[model samples]
Target: MTGRSDEYPAAPKAARRNRGFEAASRLLRERIRTAGESRGFAVSRLLTHWPEVVGEEIARMSRPVKVGYGRNGFGATLTLLVEGAAAPIVDMSREQIRAKVNACYGYNAISRVVLTQTAATGFEDGQAVFLHSPKPKPAPSPEVQAAARATAEGCADDTLRQALERLAENVLARSAARAAQKKG
Candidate 1:
């Protein structure tokens, strides 16, 4: 009150600096790690990047459920939820699966893989969804594209014409694929 007015003290320079918004992933990383740990996944990459850790073929038929560590914490067993029909196929590739999972951790973290077979519809434990990255659609053939362009040539607007051409190409390609399947 002597010389200065009754204004509140200024915030520290570090706190005053405008640190822009943070990404959702960055903000939730620790929470995600904690949740993954509760599910016995020490390294979250195995769950997040399962398709990349294992080949697409394996990932398509299986999903990592949990990791059960030994009493000594030396050899962990990875449990995979697999479709009933694919269980045998996955069992045959157990060693390969173990190797791939261990490689993902950069260590021999998983000693074995145990398969839990379930119906295609999955179980009631809220693990029913088994999804993977979609396979990329093949490019339409040159012939199909040319035909589509020809069909769309009557359209007046350039953008509309291009969109129509894409639609025609997709329809024609799908028909061609069906025809080929019938022939085979």
Candidate 2:
């Protein structure tokens, strides 16, 4: 047999192109990682908006009923409860949604999404799903403060400082409620 050359075998043109694509993908991934870390975003926080993150995937399978915050903060994992035509379709849809969510988070935050069929309505209207941003933290008000303080001090269990703190929180909540009612 002829002696082999030290040089490697020549890669096909397609293989060379694939390598280039891989390199580009790697660079893009590194940039995203660096940016995410620098933005002070914890991995947990990023996982929150799994739905929005995987929007493209969700669109492919099931229509997004509600794309908003879940239990977490704003733009967190989207609560995507879908009602598709058939069970098999719905199952595949859920998987697609899951993939999209994972892709969106840039990690596997969502293991599986809860899926359900829409209740039959006479007109075939879509399911009633509510999507909303996280409720803003109500600010402390003067009255809440006073009440909290009274509750803390008079209660005997809490210290004076604790009472004041409680009062502050109570007052703030009351004020917020009032403002919300007025808006409504």
Candidate 3:
């Protein structure tokens, strides 16, 4: 045969019709493993399964930066990069997070969890998805605005009156839109 035969002794041409890919996620795992090794990330799928390990809420507020080991074979410390003003929130769930991480590794891999406050840019290289609130809709019509103003005319506190007016306007505009939609 023209081809070298050391590896496979030239598998019959028909025997190698096609070799399609394995799962894409499995393929990506090799890159992930290499990244973990190079970047000192926890090799226990912490970054991949973050949402499952921690609930969605906490996952958005925090992410595991790295697992730092103690000398003399002691337990390791998990540094979590928490975003913005959610430091207290992450601090409150420290033990719970440690327990969950240990369970994931099937061992006491983490002795303590450290919360490090970070900017949103902390996850710049990641594909993490966070829950976002829907944008508030603009008021639909001038009639709703007028009705809201009329209803708020007698209020003593200006701020309270303005808030109440806005609330009324939004509610009235929504109902009016729904009614028009039914007719149309």
Best by TM-score: 1
List, residue by residue over 1-184, the lDDT tens digit for candidate 3. 5566675565566665365877887778888888776655556478888989988988989988888887866788888988758999889999999998888887987898988776756266644445798898875588888999999999999999999998898888888989999999
- RMSD (Å) of each candidate, 1 decimal: 11.0, 20.1, 16.6
Candidate 2, run of 10 with poorest lDDT: 39-48
For every model shown, the clashing-pair count is 0, 21, 0
Better of 2 and 3 by TM-score: 3
Clashes of 2: 21
In candidate 3, list every pair of residues with a backbone clash. none
Q: What does candidate 3 score on TM?
A: 0.55
Locate the minimum summed-lDDT window of 10 residues in model 3. 121-130
| TM-score of every candidate relative to the true structure | 0.59, 0.26, 0.55
Give the Cα error of residue 118 in candidate 2, in Å: 1.3
Q: Which lDDT tens digits does candidate 1 get at residues 1-184? A: 5656556676667645366887898899999899999989999999999999999999999999899998998989999989878999999999999999999999998998999888546365535555787899999999999999999999999999999999999999999999999999
